[model samples]
Target: MEEAARAGRTLLGKRLLVTGGSRGIGRGIVLAAARAGADVVTCYRTPGEAVASLEQELARTPGKHQVVRADAADPAEVNRLVAECEASLDGLDAVVNNAGSFLPRPYAELEPEEWDATLRGNLTAAHLVTRRTLPLLGAGSSIVNIGSTVAFLGMAGGVHYTAVKSALVGMTRSLARELGPQGIRVNTVSPGRIATEALDEQPAEAAERERRMFSSFTALGRLGTVDDIARTVLFLVSDHAAYITGQNIHVDGCV
Candidate 1:
């Protein structure tokens, strides 16, 4: 399936901007987008080993791509990101608001500042990028907001995170209505506890425990891979999902 996606060129000739592409699921999507034949411009918040590794991996991909150091949560940086996108690829065929941070905390312990920061990074960033980049999108273009399944099912210790994540659903629906008349589509691709870099950072025993715990939550009895979510986004932005819009497509394994 992976090889087929590479050969298929699902996003052939498409120009895309994916935010928060330095690590985790965002990193996976960036790699998948380039491999699927899109001219990609992705951003990272800080410089580190992950950023360096992403650049190296993209170097071997088959499309024109750029990795910029920018914070999507900042309006000024988002403006700069859009400018770079326009300059690099002319205009965008798709925008994936994948840049955000997640720091789970108990509702009692969550500070007001943390809530505000979370909103800025996760919710406001998507709005800023989408609004600023609207001109670069046109008929047949798509905008996908990376969301979370916890928004629907709810989380015990993450009310703040859940609130912001849930906002994507309403945002996507409204934007789809607003942009549909212009022939643009908007949707949310919510992931369900997909294993990512955080897992790798855990001690082996703890990581195994987490993997097993998360897997037990799924109907499929397995955790989802980054590819599972990436492939879904690929379809959503491609001609295959041309008729679909304003919906939340969960990439979880029925968790």
Candidate 2:
């Protein structure tokens, strides 16, 4: 408990904005950023129990943080969210594009709507957030786009999702070069088979079986935790990684 309250200065006095902070890996990044001494402004798509819990957690952590209801995929909402970030933190030091959706559907069953939505969520959302927040960022600013390892290793029934993730890598690389002179860095952090709380709720036998299967997929023979992804992102956004840009850092336990 004492460790939880101890704030580190890795991102001391930095201003950060993260999308999709209500749950899953996004929530991990948000909490980790706050604990690392960043003044964070994170957004969610809707109001729910997740928001309530995140608010309570942030309230207990050091430094001021804001949680807003906004969708990063929507242009209007993205604009509003960035406006709020500027209002809360004055100017941004970093941005994390973590909000996205993935629904597995076989090629034959995949519909046009599903393809469009997945692209909007996984690819376009990152563009919208990054472009809108560019004004607030300056030299030494970092932008980390969350991606997936399946982008490299294709997954059946997820062609649309994989394509969107693939686009993120391209986007990150191009932007890193384009923005390099401005001292703004862009990168992608691709995670593989991370075990989250939802996995714990699975039936004991089934969860164990799934974990075993995914663990074997990696050279390390163990599934990843949210901390694995979060820590890599923390380093990328901090000054410790000042020279790193346009790189895709994978936290997949060597999968």
Candidate 3:
């Protein structure tokens, strides 16, 4: 099924800008877009093996691609990143606001600083990138904000994280209304728990506990994958989802 899907180039000739595209879910979307025939410009925060690997993979993909190092939360850096994208890809057809940070802690233990950082990393970063990229995105363009299922389910220790994610849904609605006349679509893709490097970093007991808990609750009896979210993003940015906007589509397996 996956092989058959890859054979269709849904985003042929389109140019895309994906933030935090060197690792995790962002990395998956980057490769998927490339395979679907979109010229991609993606940004990473730091230099590492993941970035190196992504560069190698993008080189092999048929479409024009670029990987840059920039801090999504910093306005100055975001400006540079967008400038590079415009220069490399010529113009943008889509933007995926996928750069985010998650810090789980009890609401009582969450300091003001931590709350502010969480908002800036997730919500503010998306706003900054989207604001700057709007001019480049003309009619028929789309924007997909990477939200989380926690925004709806409300995790116990992720108040700050969930708050920002919930805000993203509201943002998407507002943006869709504002951009609708211009023929641009805006939407959110809220993902459930997926096996990523971050999940593997959890302590043995905590990881196992979550695995069992989510498995029992999720109807599919399995966690989602990066590819799961990536495929949805591809569709959202493609003409297939042209009529879909201002909505939060949960990629979670019916949790």
Candidate 4:
């Protein structure tokens, strides 16, 4: 199935901008978009080891990829990132709002600054990125917002993250209704617990419990991988999903 997807150049000529795309699920989406023949621009706040590895990996791929330095919480930087992507790719075919931060502080322990930071990174960034880049997107283009299953299913100690993540659903539905007439599709991909950098901070016992819980919820009896979310995202933005929009597709392995 993976090879078949790679063989299908359905996304050829598409130009995409993905935020927080230096690593984890965002990196997965970047590679998937490129594998589907789309020109991809990924935004990152810092250049880490993952960034170096991704650049090396992309260098070997046939697809074109550009890494832009930008802070998702900064409106100015977001606008500049869009302009850079447009200049590099000629136009915007899709915007994948995948850049987000996860800090699971308890409600009482959560500071005002934490709340603001969470909302700014997760919700506001998506809105700002889309708003600035929409001008470059036209008919037949799409926007894929990366949401979390925690949006619908509450997770304790992750109040701020869950609150902002839930916002993506409403945002995508509204954007879909408004952009549909213009032939642009907006959708959300809500993923379950995936083993990514975000999860690396989890306490061993807590992480084990989470694993057990997510596995039980999923009939597949396994945790989801970054590639799973990436493949789903690729389909959503491709011609295969031309008729789909304003929907939230959960890529949580049956959870």
lDDT for each residue of candidate 3 in 157-206, tens digit (9 for 90 to 100): 99999999999999999999999999999999999988787778899899
Give the Cα-based TM-score of candidate 3 against the true structure.
Answer: 0.94
* Cα-lDDT of candidate 2: 0.93
* Best of the two (2, 4) by lDDT: 2
Better structure of 1 and 4 per lDDT: 1
Backbone clashes in each candidate structure, one number apiece?
A: 0, 0, 0, 0
What's the best-to-worst order under TM-score? Answer: 1, 2, 3, 4
Regions of candidate 3 where Cα sits further than 4 Å from its true position = 1-7, 201-209
- What is the lDDT for 229 in model 2? 90
TM-score of each: 0.96, 0.96, 0.94, 0.92
After best superposition, candidate 1 residue 227: deviation in angstroms?
0.5
Position 80, candidate 3: lDDT: 98
Q: In what order do the candidates fall by lDDT, top score first?
A: 3, 2, 1, 4
Identify the runs in model 4 with alpha carbons over 4 angstroms from their true place: 1-6, 197-213
lDDT (Cα atoms) of all candidates against the true structure: 0.92, 0.93, 0.94, 0.89
**TM-score of model 4 relative to the true fold?**
0.92
Model 4 lDDT tens row, 23-51: 88999899888877898899899978988
